[model samples]
Target: MTSSSKISRRSLLKAGGSIGLLAAATQIKTSWAMGGRSRVGVNSPEQLLALSAVDLSQAIRTGEVSCVEVMKSYLSQIDNFNPTYNAVVSLRDREELLNEAAVADADLKSGHYRGWMHGFPHAVKDLATTKGLKTSMGSPILKDWVPKHDAIFVERLRQSGAIIIGKTNTPEFGLGSQTYNNVFGITRNAYNPDLCAGGSSGGAAVAVATGMLPVADGSDMMGSLRNPAGYNNIIGFRPSQGLIPFGPTKEVFYQQLGYEGPMGRTVQDTSMLLSTMAGYDSRVPLSQKSSPSRFAGSLETKTQGLKVAWLGDFNGYLAMEPGVIDLCEKALKHFETLGGVVEAIDMQYPMDEVWQTWLTLRHFLIAGGANGLYAKESNRVLMKPEAIWEIEGGLGLSAMDVYKASKARTSWYHALDKLFDTYDVVALPSAQVFPFAAETHWPKEINGRSMDTYHRWMEVVTPGTLSGCPVVNVPAGFDHQGRPMGIQLIGRNKEDFKVLQIAHAYEQASQLTRTKPNLKKA
Candidate 1:
């Protein structure tokens, strides 16, 4: 392969014309079109638009392609579909991104490769700060707030040579499981525009699924990464707490439940992104030290003797949408065929108690984080109902309630430790339901059970959050409505790489990651 950098502008325009002609001639929806149609011809720009980040990076490194060409391809796709999907919000000027890519191409030719992600276009979740780009946390209050400095992880992404394109959308302060905010409206699923794209990483997942981006960065607290990945048929890995440094915050020793990690179309791509995102920083007191290479280097481990505990619906105690359990069960059976042993496991701890404990700690964090905004009466009206509810819930907790919640959390960790002693991994559904309608803020009920709180419908993912364990959400299969679903592999605490190993093995055996959403009508 050779770089196409020298191609004349006229030739590039002619090539673009040919792509349009091919789409009309075959009546096959090109990658730029929506409504689930197949992508364009092989080796075409349309195909390049769909390459994984790993492959795209290698192409730039080896001079097989110029960074400029790659950026143009992705930007074109984003232009065509973003209006419908509402995935890539707070977008930067295109000329600026293309200019940066041109410089990257020039540097590569001069034998100055910055890193693996050199020249790749990326956007951080809106919850994180980005210098000179709108950093709205999906709240109306921060609609015009562009930070002068980047968030720690965002800085790391820049140091690794990723060209920052913009910021993706999230829920109001990332308060809900669905990605809709007063600032930018709802982010629709890439697979089906009329359906919801699970949040608060919904924008990140949709970007990856729709070829708007090859990979993205997301944060998870109560399954933000996993739920969106499950709904969009991609990979969302929430590394163990402190594995990826989180804050330059006022309260350093707080409950520490949320984590930032990578989202991608494949496990390898996700791991490759994690390599850059994970490292120690003194500013974040809880940061852990790990060699970046360990993430991608350890992907080849075999699963021949692995023991996986399948906790589908936490042993059938949790409510699930129709066909969710069956789809996940069929996906788990692939592990048995890969020489791994699968067994049914039941939780010893009461799930309702665990759910309540999670709510207490989670709301505590929310209230603490929202202290500044809540101090001003004028800002209260701008807050979402869910945010207000969480703040009040946290404020209303008594000292004894917090102490009991802490005790329950400790017990939950102990139970997980005992389970890991006998099993290599515990598997479960990433989300309780498949993608819902785009207009609905949250599921009012599931399986005839009313969801009392806004986040109650997402109980299946709370255990991993409470235990502070690493969970990887991989593609399971699709529901009858043709929407995607996913299963999560939860590993022991701080054993982030081990969890990825099992997920990679399952990904290799099932090959479900090869599936892409059909988006021809958007």
Candidate 2:
């Protein structure tokens, strides 16, 4: 992956089969095809790209490495690999970013340190707004919409001295977990370029996994953050609901289904970014008031006598691919080595009831945001079928229907509460199936079972989502074909740090991300 041997859109087209590659082809060629200082004779710069976010931050802050060199290294990585992976889009010019890095270097010379992320090169998930950056949200209609204001997290990133380089690709308006759209074609898996990079944080995951970006900010509605990290063999942590203030948007009160989180190649990096992104904001009425600094602290924790309950496919309710469970189970065995107790537990609550509750809430929230698009006759045509379905389902719901679903959701929470009392943490597969073909929209069926809706294949994630609990997607080793999977380590409500601590211990024992992917062009 050098600028001299840069990949063409035709090669990318071959890597990611036709779905919506034309727009992506044009965008990639236009944005990153401009040559940068290639990795040729740039071993030290290449090494800079591989540094953990924490390490990079220290280097920049102490002037051990100039910010210009750090930014240049990342720009080179993006120039070389982004075309083939399609992980980054709307990238800024290399000269402009290098200049900003120079300013950061000057600030350090003046002893004007900003924060832990001083001069860190970063990219926000396309779904989030960054002032002046093109935030397409994976929709061509909004491709030119430059936000005048930053999302709260984006502001935090900037305040911490991160230079926003660009936006990562996501599904159209982030409606699904597979990353592809009319806006950006598809974000391919880091290990296998032909496979799908799970979404809606697909681009963010790939960026972190491949060193296109050090760490990233992504929001999860379904398995948006967790699934992509699992697919890319990185760490994505979805904190407890309201742990990070999200959306200065219209329906902040009612919409509790989604959360904004951090993704990185390591738990320490992810948690450090979470520290920057978390903390209370009055704009979000439901925002957590607790300080987020604890997450940035040492993740080392003793796992002796830890109790973990493995909820594998809810006793056969989830239609897993043949080896998905086995791989996650093997990953879970690492806990036993740390003197943790692992037990497989059958779900006591009705899983279907949880599904129904999730359907109602998801429809209500997704439709709430997308209804305006659906209302306009012209724009309605631009929306995907799943978006239309969510809009229609939300429009048709009566107050009684919403009330009944809320009650069911409460019952489901009680069931999880009971489990948490017995087991310190609950574990499940992050995704029911492995990464599929990049060209496919979504999995219509799994293991001879028909998926009734677009997101039903991700049923394994609902319990954690609905419970407003913290969940960490810890990488499970790859399968025979080299497809990655992950295990979800879940904690009780508002116990975000506890979950991070456990995941940190397991991460240290497994040392999974240390095994870098063997990247190849399709």
Candidate 3:
């Protein structure tokens, strides 16, 4: 049936039918693309999926392809792969998505184009609220709760004409790097379903990696975006703190650590999504007043004569899995070929103190938000054990502990700022270890060194998080096992555009983003 005719039938069914009829309507054999053309399995879904968001947006704008065709391609891929990967949860009804795509196509025909993301199918991280969609946050306690309004970032995506497909999986309240939670189980790596997809942005990374979505949105407090991007072999950019504000909160003037950003298969696609997400708003007190045009324009910036600092394992203080550092170092060499001056620099901050400060403040934040949930006798049982431990740990923290951590964080920022004076960007491995077993919650040790806490193994990303710098995870290469690895490019605070420029240069030279996962057996 034609796309519009199918939508019309579905609309009639919805108007006078039971939930069963709506469910059945989703299974109708609607045309997979516009003009009654069938692109599914005939035209390559892989090729369509491989197109950058910029290229895809242009295609939609120029009438080369309809938004319906694009949406159908992604929905087909998700149906074929999401069951095994478990990357996307809380999916909307299929008929409803196609109906929206039909509307987007109609709007385009009438010259009512929205923007770059017009008609693109995208998913928000489960942590963010999407009005009328389940905002589970990967917690069973909220399994059925739908938000009344979209989060700021989600609202921006909608305004830009991106269709909200579903919520990507995340850990409960996004507390850990690993993406598993009691609600949706585990979100496995796109490279290998047996291994974990690093999280709490794991699902977002996997969705992009597996062609389930062209690009996705995620947040980072402690490398939630970067770690998953590293594991999945994609680009995850954590913009500088306040570049994209954290909001819909009670305390507006608080010290912000977490920031929302974009994830995609390539740096250019990520920049496109970032442009839509970032802007100044009085509602988000920490939001920076900057033009989104800076991000898109910065992609054309050259890397020649740029000073690139290579920070290997934080000067050997961070424990890395075997071959992780070597892989990252090899990726760093590519910058030199692009005319970047690569320097081996030591960021000589007390590593132990940095970790202590990060933990103290992280736990403090966790406790402040979660302690109330834990206080409810009936709700306590719904919380995860690690979450409970973190909340209780925060309860025991003294005011002096928070103060000391804040002081340490300030000192670390000064050290980072001093290094930036001599370097354009600092590069390191995005994750300390490659993808591990999906069953494991967190790595207990790295290279025989014991990890005191569940999150200690992920200390490589904490420095960037603590410093509030713009960090981008670009595909580095693969290890012996062929699991993906990535290099983190840390830019000076609020120099988000420069960071994207550097990452884009390295991405173009390396071309590692072109590599696709082998999901045949998966």
TM-score of every model versus the real structure = 0.91, 0.91, 0.90
lDDT of the structure predicted as candidate 2 = 0.83
* Root mean square deviation (Cα) for candidate 1: 11.1
Cα lDDT tens digits for candidate 1, 189-226: 87788899998899999999888898999999989999
- Backbone clashes in each candidate structure, one number apiece? 12, 0, 1
Q: Write the per-residue lDDT of candidate 3 for residues 410-449, one digit (tens) a residue.
A: 9988888887777898888888998999999999999999
Q: Which stretches of candidate 2 lie over 4 Å from their true place?
A: 1-43
- Give the Cα-based TM-score of candidate 2 against the true structure: 0.91
Q: Model 3 lDDT vs. the true structure?
A: 0.83
| Ten-residue stretch with the least lDDT total in model 2 | 22-31
Q: What is the C-alpha lDDT of each candidate?
A: 0.83, 0.83, 0.83
